[model samples]
Target: MFDHIQIKVKDLKSSKRFYTAALAPLGFTVQYEGGGAVGFGPKGAPALWLGEGDSRGSVHIAFAAKDRAAVKAFHAAAVPAGGKDNGAPGLRPDYHANYYAAFVKDPDGNNVEAVCHKEQ
Candidate 1:
């Protein structure tokens, strides 16, 4: 439904390190980069973008997961690579019966999430 997203970070290199490790579990990689920004997504197209800035705002970005396990893996990989846990992997009954997801705050305090809407 959407084409891409851009986020501002305090430091490009540090944000790159955090995102590189965090998004790896979801099969996304850095697709392009310039002086003040880095982009990540599937090959040839950059979906999520990070830019250098001061006082990075709290942003919410969610990735679609193939299944619940992928969400778990995302959280697992993110935390060890400088991501702070916001939530764990589990069903979010408030959203739906099978809204399995995980949440983390990246180096720049943007709220990143991975969710799977499949029965488990």
Candidate 2:
């Protein structure tokens, strides 16, 4: 539904560090960087952009994971990468069967998640 998203962050460097590590398991990386901004997504296709500026509170951003293991890896990596644990990786039966996901708060406090909806 969206081509790309740009977020204003209080610290671009910290955000970059956090995202680079957190999104790795979900297959995202820095694809572009310039003009005080950085973009993260699959190779050659940057979707999420982060720019240095005053934070506008927080927002939820969920990335698709290939499987439950990726979701768990995301949580394990995110916490040490400067993200705060919002929710541990597990099945969210309320959402649906096989809704495995993990949540973390990014540098600017945005809720970040990696989810896999496939049954194991």
Q: Each prediction's TM-score against the native?
A: 0.94, 0.97
Model 1 segments more than 4 A misplaced = none
Error of 2 at 15 (Å): 0.4
Global CA lDDT computed for model 2: 0.95
Q: Write the per-residue lDDT of candidate 1 for residues 25-112, one digit (tens) a residue.
A: 8889999998788999999989998878875458888999888878999999999888999999888999989899999999878889
Q: Could you say which candidate leads in TM-score? A: 2
The TM-score that candidate 2 achieves is 0.97
User: Which RMSD values do the candidates have, in order?
Assistant: 1.1, 0.7
Please, what is the whole-model Cα lDDT of each candidate in the order they appear? 0.89, 0.95
